[model samples]
Target: MQHDFLKNYKHKTKESRRLYSRAVKVFPGGVSHNIRYFEPYPFFVSGAKGKQLSDVDGNKYTDYWMGHWALILGHSPKVVVNALAEQAKNGILYGTVNGVSVELAETIKKLMPRAEMMRFSSTGSEATMYAIRLARARTGRRIVAKAIGGWHGFNTALMQTVNYPFEEEEGLGLVQDEGQFVESIPFNNLDASLKVLETVKDDLACIIIEPVLGGAGCVPPIDGYLQGLEEFAKKNGSLFILDEIVTGFRLSLHGAASIYGLEPDLFTLGKIAGGGMPIGILCGDKDIMSLADPVARADKESLCAIGGGTFSANPMTMTAGLLTLNFLKENKQQVYSKIDRLGRMARKGLTKLFAESGIPCQVTGEGSMFLTHFSKNVVMDATDIANSNRELLKAYHLALMANHGIFFLPTKMAALSFAHEEGDIKKLLEATKKIIIDSKLFKRFA
Candidate 1:
């Protein structure tokens, strides 16, 4: 009666109600992001530390959402928080370049060998927007071929979800996305993609993609697909832009680009790079990135199209990014290895649960990420995911949160953080098993 999930949620906090009420008046949805929105209202966080997310209503969660997959070290890891607090005390920002920003760039370049230069923006949208812009400028092309259903920032041209076809009710006809020349294609349909590209191959400036599809249900690129994309883009005289916002850092030290041995002409980064702070980055060759720094140009004049923001590389965020990267570098083996173990544990546990229940459920994801789609079959692309058992999955999501303490990304695509341990995986698996046992939909399989 008094906002369900509060008396129900174990870590309900007070700010949830206040934030929701205060936010609705200022913002349409009371939240700036889609994933944060819920049926009645969303919980407001008082703070987070380690793997715990404390809601304004005093609800403490095990935090599988992990700040939407950015807190690689988990919640307020002392290294990042202390860096931010210390930097905040020294002062927040100025109108000039700083040391930490340079350090963060150098650290990322070391991981992504293909990246020789970089620039930081506040959000993934800006990073991606600039990436596509750079592609167009360098190639002098008009069209950008992106994988269908891939959400690249908030750019009007790239918001379409990958692996999922547009709903007819939305009235977005198939030929093109309203006005933009964004041509969408299936992730692994090599021949189909090639054939489609042939239509406007000459006009294409870039073919941007996610190495492992994060949205459209955590779909991974099929084997040889990445290579095919690279070859195809090059042969057609187009730039390949790797959108690793979600997969960056989380996938490996090299991120998705290095893990797949991808050599992209342009790269966009976000998510974990910010260390839970708002940050976005676009990087590539020295010649290309020089467009952003006018002094590096032959003309010696900067242009607005080069991408710059006032609070783009703010001090506190840069400090957090620097600290997070330092921790990631020093503990590379431990952190990556530990997160991999957690992924394996969750994947194995869920596979066992779904198999025993005779329910066609599947867990697909990589790195410190996993998406539990209610289908016991292999999902290669969007169509397979679209027909997944959403009803059962949503019910399972609610059950896991309500009956048990495990929290997940409400949209089915879940992220794992370092704070999670074997015990955390076990607890989630145990809860999921019970939810399966209690679900009539799960029983229907039997």
Candidate 2:
């Protein structure tokens, strides 16, 4: 069947147009989050099952983005659905400790050994924010060190002043975007980052890093980089905190820490721990996490300055988490093996398509999460992602959505899940190949 990329394709996303128009009246950009809004509007999803996502417009997609990389079991897994229903019947929020909450903590501690004790929150941002604060309280310092494209959350501390074009930034008399209090250093450049750490040594409380940079693309670190960081943080008297929000259970039961062979004093978990529920956890040694304990902090009237929220570890999410944790623990190895196969296939297929067109591209990922990077070569850090062809990446995402229902995160990130099979992987590869052929992006890069 003959189709149109610009003409007929635009009509298919009509519901997005209508929704965005209505959304803008109440919200700033027809969407709550900045990234959720794309082009005329975003294609809203009505439902998801296994590896498929059905948009409000009735188009079905083989989704690799996996709900922004949250659903490792994929959308509406039977186990999660049953667990959630049972938990719901019991109660949603108890506003206090419960059996399920303790269960999740114990499971996390067992899997991620460095996490001796754990606290909870409802989002990755909160977990990381509190971790940073905890590090500061432990060390009595302020400055934080992180990778260039590191995304702990959209929190101002980590999100600000990253991925900016320094050359253009100079002319604008600003760093990049609207953010404050961040010391942006180039990624994968150990010397450059070390210099920043050295300069801020005195004031630095901790160095928080994502073992495998996820949002910047699933780019792994160079040899000895994570270890060197541990050495540096130790020498400087700062704590080492690993942001495992995305990598935690998704990469492995032990996550990047175990895989990379490093031990962070404190760690965080986000994507899979909640078990399709909304929750975040910061786990670390008993001494460190105790900072949040009212008794440990002392000066009861010291303004409740530490981090603890009423709904931080509600009962329902904990119940779902327990169910998911048990399932994952029992089948962790098998799940990773299957997903890794899919990851390799999709990455290889996408590379071959780009090769045919002579497009300078690379696929970086771990386990099942993959990203199609438009660059001269494979990158080891966020700097390459910042300097690469974002416009082409955007076009690729849009084309894949149109040419075939092979959905990915609009942000050039592909977060695969356990539900994806070989067929889904093939569909995504075929769809990607079509986009490369149709867009002629290779020539544009040439």
Candidate 3:
């Protein structure tokens, strides 16, 4: 059978293809970010409104990627946009401490009671990097333990065993032996994690984990997994740092820390916390965060030396975040209710469609984040996902985008926003059914 999906995609996205031809001359892989690049080329989005994206080719898609899972309220949310606009008129950057920054921090503290003190950074990577440094400085240890597939950031220190094969190192230009400072343990496996922690107990500075394995397919931790990890970390004299970059506001206003009743020693947040702007935050107990304070510094050697960038807590991001947080705080029940319903709808619909079509697959996730795997077994961890048929999964994802106009991350992870309604969920399910039948994936699996 002819692959009409690929043909239709190429024809519909002719303009994006032409642009990619020019972009390749400037960018390494014709894309600024690696994830944005796929087999044929990604569609250049002209604009976005709510949960819909209009590509340059005038093809409108129900955007499940949602700005890399940051736009919980959907793209260009009116509240955030209006706040940003008002802030821009006053001034964009002040290069000094501002009132809005304090307000934003206060809002975070109110939402996350454990955030006694907080410091701002420019990106999620910087927040995680600083959190790791603080843990090392406070504990006077050299090693950090992370889950096998957890993606903290691009920082070299936490770059080992992320998304790549578990046996091989994922760091590219990391300093020699830097990977040794970081150890990987199986996620959601208390016994395996404890074993690794026992081995690295002496040198372990921190155990950083994402409550839900965001990039590895939104796999939630087993019942007491997070709490167990925290206990193990404490027992080993290591701090627990929760990376809530993707789940901060997307999962709950207070993040996974609140949902799981986890009291991490340090928390790194970004994504929705930025209100669609570039921002990162590291918040924790006052004593731990004080190590980064210039005024509290006893001496140069005593401080952790966490640096801030030029636009670390600019007014624009502060205003936008403040508005976003306030909106979430006021309309918590309504927003979360809609997103949770949408998530259940999508998962149930996909599972039924795939099963009826005789395709062996499993949908794994919690709340608003989910991903489809081409396997019948339950996905408990990253290894389970890595063992599946990745090529076929990628083909299915491509088919969804090409033929059905349902955009998802090429890794198959998807999310729902408050903007998604019952009708949108129905549309997505119908499109998915059509794609499965048209792509003939069921025949291959059968």
Candidate 4:
């Protein structure tokens, strides 16, 4: 079955293979982004609309990746696209302040009361980096505490313990001793998290975490885990930073912080907030955010120096974001309920399918995001995921893409957008069932 699937994949994606052959000479690993690369070669997407992605090879897939989990409203929503088109005619970038940026900021503030003051950056990584810098500057500390397997961004301070084995450094050219400044605590383990925070309390500036572990398989925190972390941070004289890059708008209109009743000292947001454009936002209390205020600072060195990129808060992204947020605000109840229902349906259906096939599986996550684990043990943290049958999970992901026409992050997580419907969910379940039966996956697991 595996061999046959490979043959079919190769035949269907011959054009993609040809493109990759050219791409390899230009980009490392034949892909601009590492995650886009997969075994054999990843198909080149020609277009995306609603929940469907059309590949260059003429195969259409039900896309669950959703622009790396950024497009909650799905691709090319009319409002966002129209706003972008209009904004493009006026100007893309002014290299100065704009009304659209102010409008977007006001909208975000209305939704997130904790964001008393906010600033923009070009990408999630920059937002997280600025948040860390602000925390350090405000608290007069250098150390940060992060959850084990939590992914904040690619920034040096928060890059440790992300998908890599605990205590193992994951990237190259990291600033020396930067890893020392980051202490990892087991996610959802209140006692262990407290102990780690206490150990580094003296120098700990903040505890940064994702309310729902994003790239580490959508593991939501155990009940009260976020609240406990916030309390611990305050008790230890450290700030609490919520990295809502993935959960800010996708989880709810107000974000995970609001849903969980978490009042972090700082919050980093990206993804869906940009309305499918490149954006990052850092928002927090006025006292903490004042460090980034250029007018208040007498000199450049006096403030934290949260520099902006040339493209940060450009008119195009601002317009798109404003339109997206306005739509979400207007239809909050309907949008949230539909996506939540879809997510629940996917989880329940997938769980039943796996069980009926005699496969050891666990479905985890909340709201519109989820992940599949090829394991019997309950997954509460990253280590549990690391210990699962990863090869089997990879095989399953490949099978889904090659045979089932479903596309998500390779064996990582799946997201449901407002564009996903009952029909799409039904197709996913049916395809999964067919894969389980035809690939003999049930027998192998048994």
Stretches of candidate 4 exceeding 4 Å from the true structure: none
lDDT of 1: 0.77
Per-prediction CA RMSD (Å) = 3.2, 3.2, 1.4, 1.3
- Compute each candidate's TM-score over C-alphas: 0.91, 0.92, 0.97, 0.98
True lDDT of residue 115, candidate 3: 89
For residue 93, what is the lDDT in candidate 2? 79
In model 2, where is the ten-residue run with the lowest total lDDT? 166-175
lDDT of 1 by residue, 24-79 (tens): 99987887876677644666777888988776666667888887778889888888
lDDT of 2 by residue, 292-332 (tens): 77765677643224444777777767866777788888887
Q: How accurate is candidate 3 locally (lDDT)?
A: 0.87
Which parts of model 2 have CA positions greater than 4 angstroms off? Answer: 1-3, 166-181, 296-298, 301-305, 439-441
For candidate 4, lDDT tens digit of each residue in 1-446?
Answer: 35566677888999999999999999999987778888778899999999989999999888999998988899999999987888788888899999889999989999999989899988999999999899999889999888889887777778888875777768678775878888999999999888778888999999889999888878998888999999988887889999999998888888898889999989999988899999999999999899888888969787888856999998888888889899999989989999999999999999999988778889998999988898889999999999888777777777788887888767778888889999988988898888887875556675
TM for candidate 3 is 0.97
Better of 1 and 3 by TM-score: 3
Which number leads on lDDT?
4
Ranking by lDDT: 4, 3, 1, 2
